[model samples]
Every structure is written in C-alpha cells, then in structure tokens.
Target chain A: MTFEVENVSKTFVSGDSDEEVIALKDINLTIETGEFVSFVGPSGCGKTTTLRIIEGFEKPTEGTVKDDGELVTGPSNQRGFIFQNYSLFPWLNVIDNVIFGLNINGKPEKESKKRAMEYLKTVGLEDFAERYPSELSGGMKQRVAIIRSLINDSKSLLMDETFSALDIQTKHKLQNQILKICKEQKKTIIFVTHDIDEAVYLSDRIVVFSRRPGMVKKIFEIKMDHPRDRQCQEFEDLVSEVIEMIGEVEED
Target chain B: MKKFRNEYTKETLILPIILIIIWYIVCDVFQLIPSFMFPGPTDVANSFVRLAVSGKLFKDVFDTLYKVLFGMLLASVVGITFGIILGWSKRLETLCKLVISILRPIPPIAWIPFSIIWFGIGIGPAVFIIFMGCVFPILISTIDGVHRTDPVLIEAAESFGASNSQMLTEVIVPSSLPYIVSGLKVAIGIALMCTISGEMIGSSSGIGYMILTSTSLFDTGSTVVGMLVIGIIGIIFDYIFTKIQERIFW
Candidate 1:
C-alpha cells in the first residue's frame, strides 16, 4: 500500500498544566508499497509519533494520512503494530496468542490454529506453542509478537523500537530475520528507532527527524545490496552520517 | 502423605498442635477455665460426634453452604456485568461513584432490618445479606482490573480490527481476570461473615443458628464445634481460590 503523510503536525497538552509541547511540525512523506523505511532521530523527536499517526493510534493535530488515496481514519487489520513491550497476552499461550487476531476477525478456529502452528514452526517456536509469554525469553516473545501480526496478513507493519530492549546478539538475529521475512512476503514496513546501525542495516530508505517540534531533517537511500555487510566501510560511513545528523539535532 | 511432610506443612502444623495441647491441659487436666465458658478438647470432640450422628451438622453445613454459594453467584453475575460497563465507560463510573461510596461503607449487618422487611426471616434475608457483603469487593475489583488493562494491549487489539464486544471479551476481560479473582478472594471472607451474622439474627437453621442456640442452651462444646466447622470451610474456600489465582496469573 502507498502511504502519504500530508503536512502532519502534533501538539500535546500536559494533563495538569496548560503548557503545550509541539512534537511534530509540518511532517510530509510518502512510502511506496513493499518498501522498508526507518525513522531515526534523537529523544523527543516525532519518530514514534509519526509511526503512531500512520497506524491510526494517534491523530495528527494538523494533517491526515492517506493510504492509497483513501483517508486513514483509524486502526485497521491492514496495518499491524508491534509495541515496545507487554504486547502479548500473558494469559494466552504462544499459539493462542498468535491466533488472537484471526480469532477476533472470525476466522475458522481449526484453520486459524493450523496456520498459527505453521507460523510458529517457521520461527522455530513450534515446541513452545503451549508455553505462556512469561516462559519465553525476550527474543522469543518478540518473535511470537512478530508472527502474531504477520499471520493476520497486514499490508504494512509498524514497529516502535521493538528490538531496543533485547541484547545485541538477539537484536541482530531478529533484524536479519525481519529483513528476510519482509522480503519473502513483500510486506511494507515502517520502523521507528534511535539506533543508527539498525536503521542503516535494515531500511531501504531512512528518514531522519530533528529534535522536538520534529521535522523531517533528511532522507537517505541505502544502495547496498541485501545481506549488507555490517563491518564494511560503506555501512560504517552511512551509520556515521546518520549519527552526525542525530547529533546535530541533539545539539540544537 | 509426602505432600504433608513438606516444610510448609510441618511449620503450619506446629502452631495448631501446640495450641490444641495447651487447650487440652488448661481445660481438661488442670480445670483452669470453667467448662461452661470453654469446653475441653474431649468435650468438643464428643459434641462433634453427637451432632454428626444426629445428622443436624450435615443439614446446618449444607444450609450455610447453599446461602453462601447462591449469594456469591448472584453477586458475581451482577457485579461483573456492572463492573465491566462502569469500567468501560468513564461517564457511568463517575455517575455511580457517589452512590457506591455511600453504600459501600455501610456494614452488611446494618442491612439486616431492611433484609428482614423485604424478604422476611429465612434463607432469603441471609442470601441478601451475603450479596450485600460480597458485591462491592467483586465490583470494585473488576473495575480496577479493567482500568489497569494495558493500553498497549488495547491498541494492539484495535489495530487488528477488533470490534467493541470482541475487545471487551478478548482483551479486557482476560487481562482483568487477575484483579477479579483477587476481588473474589476478598469477597469470600465477607460472604462467610455475612452468612453467619445473617443466620444468627434471622434464620432458624445453619451453623450460625446452631451456634446461637447452643450458646443459649449453655452447650459450649457444641458451639465450639460450630465455630470450628466455619473455620474449616473458610480454609477450604481460601485454598481453592488461591489455586485459581495461581492458574490465572500464569
């Protein structure tokens, strides 16, 4: 699906105070179908806010998002969101959690379970189908969370720092796995994170945001081939370039 | 047998055994306390056997059990339904807050007069009293549980195209279960207290009635037996609820 964020801006009023915080300002962008995009910026930047607006979790104060020329009014199954934590239902076991969306949408129970099991098997979590979220490691839980969305056939996946809480090794493995999955499925992905290396490694295009009253500072296209080498000079240079942009925002 | 030999079981048994031995010595061996005020262990045991043989104990136990369970069932249905609605809607919760606060503080025993006038002195009054005592805790807990449901989870559900009812049943209810169960735990104790107090004042049957009549007749041994039976039932209910809590939280 093609997404157009037309001149979006967000303002937040503190609950007890009259002070207003401008989070985003005149943000405009377009994402092509099946393209992998990343939004990176310093803290208080509107990276997460932009992603939430696109997902229809939050509405922009002064703009609208159009998905394929249709107004995006609210959250739909067409766009799936993965939160930073507590995304899985603790009461549900792995396979059950995976099938939750399908069940809600009124898919056949037998078929839903069968499809959920297949997805779990693909992630090497088939043996853990009966286990609860609390029993799974952080990485494992994230894997389940990812599959939970993917199995619903969402056209675009919105991820908000979904791998930031994991250890380095688990994060790298998941990043690689997500890349493979998106490519194989040809799914559109919009990722929000502060990690520059991750943005350069996974994104086809990276949109950098300025510090709050966040505006789109720059957009970089990574021309590196798939399975890009993290140790290569070209990867390091792009990472540095993105880091410099964020550092400049932080300074301002 | 092995389960009973665990550290927790052994520690728990030590205090009760010591208390029983001290009671046996004071009441039976030394005659330190009058039998009328406090019966000896053998006297209570004899009274227990007599009541059991007469089948009155079984009848009284069943009567109290029926009142407690039935009252709780009614309370659960009403409380959960209202709780979900109130919790889901801020306007409703705010509208009912003042009335709920006023009613919640009034003791269940205080409702005895109204209960008698409304239902008369029988199982109906007893059940009403139990419902009064239990409903608030369950209702409040369910409300708190729903309020505490993670927004992230709700967002996730909404993004998946969950309708209002599906959101309530699938995300809200299950997430709030831990809170509701805890509320039920607190309510069970209140339910038992209401049952006994209601039966003592209004009913002609139940363990509460048995205790009241035995005390009036100066049959302290039988009264002690009645109290012990209530205690045992409380312990059993608590054990069952604790097991349920553990299973739900996982």
Candidate 2:
C-alpha cells in the first residue's frame, strides 16, 4: 500500500494583519509501505504542517492525500499520530491510557485490557499499569504515549518531533526503541524533526525541507544496515549532506 | 507542656478556649449584652442538649441537609448536561451567554419570592432555591473546563478516529474533571447558603428556621446552637469533597 501527497500548498491568513503567509508550497512526496521517512528542516519550515496534513488533522489548500487511492478527509484509526506533548490523559492510569484508542473504537474490555498489558510489558512498564500520568517522569510519560499510539491497529505512524523535549540520553534510548519496534512491526513511519543527526540515524530516507513556505530541497536515501552508527563515516557524510541542504536554503 | 504545645491537640485548642473564656467573662460575668441577647457558652451548650433531647436539632439539621443534597444532585445533572452541550456548540453557547449572565448575578435569596410563588413554601421552594444557586457555577466551570482542554489532547484523540460523542465522553469530560470538581466545590457553598435562606424565608422546619425562630423568641442560646450546626456541616462537606477530588484527580 502506497500513501501519496500531490501538489499540496497551505496558506495561513493572519486574522489581525490579514496577511496571507504561505506555510507550504507545491509539496509532492510519496511514502511507500514499511518505509521510515524523516522530514528535517529549520523552524517554520512547515515539516509539522506537512505531517499534520497527512494525518488529516489539517486540510491542504491545494492537494489531495490518498491512502491506497482513498481520499483522506479527517482523522482515522488507520494512521496513528504520536504527539510531542505526551498526550496521555491525566485522569486515566497508565494501562487505561494505552488502551484508550481501543476503548473509543468499541473494543471489549477484556480484549483491550489484554492488548494494553502486552504493549505495556513490551515497554517494560507493566509494573506501572496503575500509575497516573502525574506520577511518571517526562521520559516515562512519552514512552506511554508511544505505546498508546502503537497498541492500536494503525498501519502507519505520524510522529511530530516527539523526542525533542526529552533529555539526550532518553532521546537516544527512545530512538533506538522506536527503530527496533518499527522494524519488527514493519510499520510505515513518517517522522518530522529539526534535529538532522536524529533524522540521519533513524530514517530509511531523509527529506530535507527549505525554511519558510517549505519546499522539498532534497531527498537522500540512507542505504545503511540496521543499528546505524553515528560514528560511521557514511553516517557522518549523510548528516553533513542533510545539514548542507538546510544551510543552503538559509543563505537564500 | 512543651510536648503538648508541639502537638496540634494543644495548639488547636488554645485560641478557641481563650475566645470562649473571654466570651464568658464579657457576656456572663459583666452582663454586657444581656443573657437574652448573647448567651454564655454554658447556656448555648444547655440549649444544644435541650434541642437534641426534644429531637428538634436532629430533625431540623436533617431537613436542611436533605434539601441541600437533593438540590445539589439536581444542579449537578442539569449543570453538567447544559455545560457539555453549550460548551460543545459555539452558536448555542453564545446565545445562552446573555441569559446566563443576567440570571447568575441574582442571588438565590433574591429568588425566594418567586420560588415561594412557584413551588410554594417548605422543601420544594428550598430545593428550588438551592438548585438555582448551585447550577450556574457548576455550568460555567464545566464549560470553561471543556473549552480549555489541551489542544494537543484533542488532536491526539481525533487522530485515532474518536467520534464526536467519544470525544465528549472519553476526552472532554475526563480532561475537564479538575475544573468540574472545582466548580462543584464552589457550588456546594452556594447550595448550602441558598438552602438556609430558603428555609428561613418560607419553611417551618430546618436549621435556618430554627435560628430565625429562636432569634424572634429571644432564645439566643438556641440560635447559637443552630449557627454552630450549619458551620460544622459546611466544614464536613468541604472535607469530604476535597478527599474525593484528591482520589480522582491525583
């Protein structure tokens, strides 16, 4: 199954100024099944805007998003979204938070709870099944958020700078965990990040975006093996290549 | 003495005991306000015992308590329902805002005449007054809670295919719980005040009626007893509400 974006453009009109700001321009990209694609660019580059457009959280002004030839209009269960803010409900315990998607979809309690338990166990958080969001640390909360999104039957995941708020150690650890899980599940992941090194380490192909009214600068295919090492010469070269694309856009 | 002072047992009693002693000296010993106007602590305690034995204290207290609880329960149902609906629908909410603004400012006591004319005396009017008093605070709070719900949470839930009803039940309501609880806390105070005011204005039985009747009869001791009961009940409700909020929110 291939997901496609064709000739997408987004224009935001400022209410006070009545100034029309073009956030994205004529964007075209295709995400094949089971591929890890990362969008890396500077702030206001509309990487997140592009991701949200794909998730159907925001509508494109001038293009169509098709999932296997079906028009995407609004949010659906088929595309899982992992937010940066760790969107676990403060009122729900860890287990219930993870299983919330299933609950909303009318799954039986026993089935949902069992599936929730398996996901929690996969993340080594079975012991915290009853803990509330307030009781968990930042990293732990994000971990729960990730599991919450993944426990659903979504074939594709859209993650928006999910680890930017985390400490470096935790960020690295989560990156590795996400990579391993995505590989095993063979899920299509479209990750958006401002961190070039992170994009380099995790993605199958990196799509560099220009600054404002973001357009695709370049797409580099990282033909490296699993457990990619940042210390490798090839990894360094790819990171530099992605950075140069970003830097070149800033110069103009 | 030091150990006793360190413990709350002694610290908490010190001020109340001192105030009571001063009260006894000024009113009983000096007869400053007259025993009929301001009864001593012993007289008040005696009145409390008399009312308890005669069954009036328990009866009146229970009547007031029942009205408050029943009214609050009604207010909660109506408040939360309207809150969610108005909170969800922008157009309806804007339309109702004018009416709510006009009605909410009029105290429940101010509604006594209308309530008496409509429901007429006793528990009905008292319950109506209390329900009116509590509903606005609860409604507004629920609306605020829903409106202020974290945008990220809404986006996350929507991304997973939550329908509008699912969004209400699972996301909006639960996320707005803290605000709702706070509104309930404020509403409880208003409910009690309205219940007492309604009872005082129209009812024949209730702590408020007891206090009003005792004042007219120059039974200051019984009036003091009634006041103390109301204060204690309010404290207990606040404590219980806090405990429940902590358990659910924390």
Candidate 3:
C-alpha cells in the first residue's frame, strides 16, 4: 500500500528540430499506506508527468517508481488512474462504461453487469445504467469515472485532476463522494490538482511543486480531521498558507 | 447559426431561379440550335413521358441500380477490412504503401478494357469498375479514421488491461465510426458514377447505356432525358446519405 518515487526526471525533446524541454527534475517523494496525497502546482509544472511515471504510463529518465515495495514498470490493476478528461466511451451507456474495465479483465458479461450495477448504485447512479456517457453531466461523468476505476477493486488510485472539468458545486459534491469512498474502502489515493481548495479539502498531505523542471518545493501534512470545514479559521489559514507557497514558488 | 438555415435556403433560391430564366431565354425563346438538333426542357419532359409509358426504361434503371448497389456492398466489405488492418499495424501498412501508391492512380475508366477482357461484357465487368472506383476512397478514409482515434483513448484502454482484440473491437472501431461512415458516403457516390460510366462505355443496358444508345441514334430529347434521370438519381442518393448522417450522428 505504500508508494515510493526516487529522483524521477523527464525531458521531452520537442519538435522535429529536437529542442530539449526538461519536464521534471529530481523528484523524490514517499506516500504512506492508506494516506491520501495531493500534488498541487501551476500548469505545465510536470505534476502530470510525475503521476504518469508513477503509474508507469511514461518511464522516468533517472529513477524507479516503487509501489508497495515492488518496482513499478507499467500499469497494473493494483493501481487505478482516473483521468481529468471524461475518457468515457460515447458509444456505451453508464453501467456499460463502468463494466467495460471489468469485462476486459475477462469477467463474464452477466457477472460484470451485476458488479457494475452494484458500483453504479454506490455512486447513486443506479437509474442511469442504460444511459450513454454523452448524456451524463460533467459531475455525473466524473462519478462514473470514479466508479469505473473502483470496480477493479484496486487498493490504490492515481487520480490526475479528475474533477477539473466540473463546476464549483459539482466539484465539491464529487470530492465529498470521493472522500467518503476512500474512507470506507481504506484506499490510498494520490490526487493531482491545481486548485488550492481541492488539495486542502481532500488530501491527507499536499506536495507543492515549483515551475518548469518541477521539483517538490514543500510537503504539508494536513493535521485537521476529516470533513474539514472550509469556514473554519484553521482551514482558511492552511489554504492561504498553501496559496502563498504556490505564489512564492511561481515567483522564484 | 442553426436558426437561420430555413431563411438562408429560401434567400438562396433567388439566384438559381434567375439562372433558369436566363437559360430559358437563351434556348426556348431564342430558338437555339434549330428544333431537331436541340430540344428545350419541354421536349425532354415529353421524351421522359414516352419512355415511362413503354416501360422499357425500367430495365435500364434497374440494371444501373443493381450494379451500383452490388459493387458498393463488395467495395465496402473489402475496403473496410483492408483499412482496419492497415491502420492497426503500422509496419504492415508501410510495407503495403508501395503497392497501394502504384495501384491508386489507375482511373476506373482505364480498367474498362481490362475488365471486359477479364470478366467479359456483362454485369461482372461493370461492377468491377464501380468497385475499383469506390474502394480506394473508403480505404483511405478508414485509415484516416483509425489514425484520428485519440492515442489517449488507446492508453486508457491499455491501462485497463484491454487485450488487442478488445481494443480493436471496443476502442478503435467505435471511435472510428464517424470517419468510416463519412468515407462510405463518399465512396457510394463515386461507385454510382463509375457504374454509370462503365455501363455507358461497355454494356448494352442501364441508364448510362440508354444515353449512349440515344446519342448513337441521334435522339437528342431521349439522350437528354437519360442524362436527367442519371443526374436526379445521383442527387437523390447523395441526399439520402446526407440525411442519414445527420440523423444518426447528430
């Protein structure tokens, strides 16, 4: 359940002319078992690059990613990634979309449908099992995505700004649902986000990244309890503290 | 933008109507090309009525339709199968590029002499030409469709443990549906045109043949009537395809 990333770096050679753009620097971080971690930084700060490397979508230039003491080389069912983009099959309905992953695992059609329905109901989308993903709202789509990843029964989730498209109210609602699911399932989740409030609201720890050629500038442990209130002075102060950290890193 | 389409169509009719009036003035009013050599729209309409009464025209119409339909069906199956394979495997596609480039430039009409030599002077030769004309457009579009499928979508599938079969069936095909359908529409039109041309050049039946025969007999009105039918049928088929695209993909 614990995850470790050591000295990970990436440099993308842009264009046919081969201009080198360093995307990630020597990034070293460790995530504890069952802990919820969030990576927050400016756009194009290589936060996505780091998460991708951990999930084995892309190889790190200089380091190895270890998940629960095993060297991670490529994607495994042990870790689920829910992307920021909808990425739903427009041709498939809601439950079918959720069951899509399970069916790929060689689960029987009937059994996968049953399991999919169970997860759909968990996300409170039981009525929309037959409706296509294109018909779902942005927030509802995110819920489907979360359930889709959860259907694999993975113990860890690698979420890359999964709620970035939802409006404020929808984002809040889905975040609450994610928190609840994580709490009940005891799943360790590493979430990536640029929003200050979201990182504070969902994370057990927040790792701030500096600009281009990103490296971890600071890692803050949120000492506050679950269901943390945004109205609370401590929560607001912590949010401002993280905001200041982000601004200071950007200027530097 | 959508709200103004009806009004836009209505306004656009003015230019076409004026052009028709000018055409009428130049032909019917001016007595162009002497009466026997060039008939007006009225003569063409009369020829259409005469052909419809005798019922000989139906067979020609049926022949052309059957050839085009059969050819298009065959072309679609062959083209789509090859297209999927080519798009899915880059190495195989690269190897076949030399063959495809060499074969694509040969016009369907150019195949008529060979088609007759191979399949003989009947429906078989005509359909071959039609299929050849239609197949390339379809294959090209399918390759494009597969290429257009987002790499992110493929990566998402890969992450989920989707097998090669599953990825092809679930991710690649469904995502490429829009492009495939568009290509089919284009191919169908080309198939019909090639069918008409093939019939005119070789066969003794079909709408295109009717025009060829009328021209040889110097029946200008009948020739014009055959040309009109072919044109109308082409328009109708195109219209049907356009409607289906809007209805399904809307």
lDDT of 3 by residue, B136-238 (tens): 8888888888998877777777778777898999999887777788888888888877887899877878888888788777777788888878877887877
lDDT of each: 0.92, 0.89, 0.85
DockQ of each: 0.79, 0.69, 0.40
DockQ of 1: 0.79
For model 3, name the residue pairs that clash: none
Top TM-score prediction, candidate number: 1
Provide the TM-score of chain B versus the true chain B for each model in turn. Answer: 0.96, 0.93, 0.89
Better of 2 and 3 by TM-score: 2
B78: Cα error in model 1, Å: 0.9
Model 1, runs deviating above 4 Å: B1-8
Query: What ranges in model 3 sit over 4 Å off?
Result: A108-136, B1-36, B40-43
Rank the candidate models, highest DockQ first. 1, 2, 3
Kindly report the docking quality category of candidate 2.
medium
Q: Which stretches of candidate 2 lie over 4 Å from their true place?
A: B1-12
Q: Report the CA-based lDDT of candidate 1 relative to the real structure.
A: 0.92
| Ranking, lDDT, top scorer first | 1, 2, 3
* TM-score of chain A, every prediction, order shown: 0.96, 0.96, 0.95
Report how far residue A146 has shifted in candidate 2, in Å.
0.8
lDDT of 1 by residue, A41-83 (tens): 9888989999999989998999999987889999999998998
Q: Which ten residues in a row have the lowest lDDT in candidate 2 chain A?
A: A115-124
TM-score (chain A only) of candidate 2 = 0.96
